[model samples]
Target: MQRRIIIAGGGTGGHIFPAIAIANALKKIDPETEILFVGARGKMEMEKVPQAGYKIEGLEIAGFNRSNMFKNLLLPFKLLKSLGQARRIINEFKPQAVVGVGGYASFPILRKAQGKGIPTLIQEQNSFAGKANMVLGKKAKKICTGYDGMEKFFPADKIVVTGNPVRGNITQSSVTREEAAQHFGLQRGKTTVFAVGGSLGAKAINEALHPLLASFVEKDIQLIWQTGKPYFETAKTAAAAYASHVKVFEFINLMDFAYKAADVVISRAGALAIAELCVVKKPVIFVPYPFAAEDHQTFNAQSLVNKKAAILIKNDDAAAQLGTTLFSLVQNKALMEQLEENIGKLGNTNADMVIAKQVMALIG
Candidate 1:
């Protein structure tokens, strides 16, 4: 008999990519395994999941609006409608297990699955668990975590520290520095710095680096910058003066090359970003998005800073401190090498497989 499973959630690349990684791992483990993805309608996963060659069903759901209470008036109705839709999908798919990867669609599908006495797994990808995951964790058969000490959030007995699954391209990258440099239209011998601020772009990171483009050129340093969409024009205009040394992108499709080309990285401390950084083994200075739920991004960065594996800059201080910090770190070869070695020790390249096997265990 073919085993069927439903994986749910996704809003950002953080949630969507890891969810796809798990689905891929499951297929690799059993070619006969049937998988269906459930995501919030109009979310990124609806498009990205299909691009990855998987079938997905979208729920008419939206997350709670934290900024404007007026926008949340229809939230309850949306949730109820989504729950009904989730039940129909579950009844038709008849999945042996359901996995929630954290996002708006996750709650309805997993809640409906648990109500039906179906085995469900929760993959909590943060140092601090969200309200939805914490509530669902009560009935979950297993809670897979990306960070240690998640017992504070979920049932300790059901928790398994599986580390977050990173995209395969990064974990198995064979891109050399020369190839990466050529791909980005930069030179191999120059010091290269890569900055990424998630998929939406970071205002602090962009503002901090804007005035420093000339300094980068003067120092003969090369920068490959992913400005997201909003910051693309501004970043492009700023880099126009130093086109030879700076490459600006709205969204980088080939991150494996970016990682290989970089000597040091400046990034936001999101869980998936941290997971990929661990695999790439680059010396990283993390500027945690201060607005993250429970300020979890800060906790994520501090975890590595405590291990001497990475550096942290508060979002508020990025404008005043980022350039100086980057310059000093680039000059310190020993510290860079030390950070790279310690961070590499934290990478778990097989997390997708481990989580897949656990899901299969639930099926048995």
Candidate 2:
């Protein structure tokens, strides 16, 4: 009998990318394995998972809204509805195991799977567990984590320190810096900095980089900026005067190329982003999103800083210090090399495969 797996999650690329990586790993181990995805109705996973050539069913669910207490009034009803929907999906799919990568949508699916006595696996990308994952961890047969000390979150015996899974193109690309620069139509021999604010874009990061636009071009510094959808038009207009030295986009789907072209990186410290940077081996300035669940982004970056791996600038001070910090990195070869080598030591290139194999063994 062919084995079937259910991958559930994705409100951001951090969760979506790792989920896809795990799915690809499962298929590699057993080519005949059947895979399905479960996601929130309007989240990016609906499009992204299907694009990865997997079937994903949507649940009518939403996470708690800290911004509006009144908006959370319907939380109980939605949770109940999603639980019913997940039961139907799991029953129809008849999955051998369900793998959750940490999103609001994943909670109900994994919860119902546990109730049904189906094996459940979890991938906790963040060093700190989200509330939902914390609850889910109680029953997860195997919990794969990017960082150590996760036994504090899940069962000690069930934990696997497999690190976070990154994309194939990011880990195995043969594109050179020069080639990537040409692909982005950027000039050769200029110091290039890559700035990405994640899937929705960071308003503060965008504001910080916006003022440094002309200075970047003036100092022969090229920037590969992913402004994300919300701010692309505004950022594009802002950079029009120095358009030649900058490449601004709503998204960079070809991140492998972008990573190659970068001399230094300025990014929000998402877990998957940190994992990719470790593999790319670049000098990076991390601006941790202060509002992340449990402030996990800061914890993620702090782990690297503790090892003397990378530099961090607080989110509030990014506007004042981001440009200067990146400029210093570009000019200081020793500092750049030190960061690259130290952070690269933390890379786990085969985490997805290790995680998938563990999940399979648990079910078997």
Candidate 3:
């Protein structure tokens, strides 16, 4: 019988990328293996998964509405509807194993798999284990994590310290400094700062960057700013005067190349973003999003700071302190080198391969 796997969940890059990484790894081990992706109907994975050359099915699912409780009054109904949908999907797919990447769709799919006595796996990307994953891990065959100390929530014997799988192009990119500078339309001789608000974008980060554009250029720093869709027009107007040294974009499709061009990076501390940063081994200043679930992003950045691998600037202090903080980082070559070295030590370029190998062991 052909080995079939169900890959479920994804609402963000942190979840989607790892799911894709595992899929690719599994295929490399057994080209004839069967795989299917299940994601929230309107989420990004529906588009991205197919583009990566995989089949996908959508489940009408939504997570809890933290901003508006009234919107979630119908959540119990949605949950019931999704579980019924997931059962039908699983019955047809007949997967031997199911992997959950921890999004809204994951719980129903994995819970169904567990009920059927099929093996289930979870890849938790955050420092704080999500409630859904915590519940799933209680009976999961394996729990792969990016950080340590997760035994408190998971079965220690079943846990594996498989660092988050970063995209290969980013983790193994070979673009040289000059090549990446050209890719960003930046001058070859200037120090470049990379700024990104992540996929959905951070409003506070965009606002903070607007007022600091002139001073940033005055210090001879070039910027690669990802202004996100909402702030593109506003951020473009703000950076119009400093176009010579600043490249403001609504979104950056070629991030590996951008990483190569950056002397310093300023970003929101999303799990996948942090994983990719560690791979590139750049000197970075992380500004964690304040409203994140349980403030997990801050915990992600603090780990790096504690290890002298990166600097953490609170979201509130971004405007008042980011410019000076970056200026100090750029001038101090020793600190920059130290951060690169310390962070480079944490890069797990082979994580996808290792986890893939383990997945094969389960099938055998």
- Candidates in order have lDDT scores of 0.95, 0.91, 0.89
What lDDT tens digits, residue by residue, belong to model 2 across residues 77-162? 99999999999999999998999998888999999999999999989999888989889889888888899988777889988899
Better of 2 and 3 by TM-score: 3
Clashing pairs in 2: none
User: What number of clashing residue pairs does each candidate have, in the order they appear?
Assistant: 0, 0, 0
Name the Cα RMSD for model 3: 1.0
Supply the global lDDT for candidate 3: 0.89
Every model's TM-score: 0.99, 0.97, 0.98
Regions of model 1 farther than 4 Å from truth: none
Model 3: CA > 4 A from native: none
Q: Is candidate 2 or candidate 3 better by lDDT?
A: 2
* Model 1 lDDT, full chain set: 0.95
Residue 264, model 1: lDDT of 98
TM-score of 3: 0.98
Model 3 lDDT per residue over 13-101, tens place: 77888889889999988999899999999999999999999999999899988899999989999999999999999999999899898
lDDT of 1 by residue, 7-96 (tens): 999999999999999999999999899999999999999999999999999999998877899989999999999999999999999999
For lDDT, the strongest prediction is: 1
Residue 268's lDDT in candidate 1 = 98
Worst lDDT run of 10 residues, candidate 3, spans: 354-363
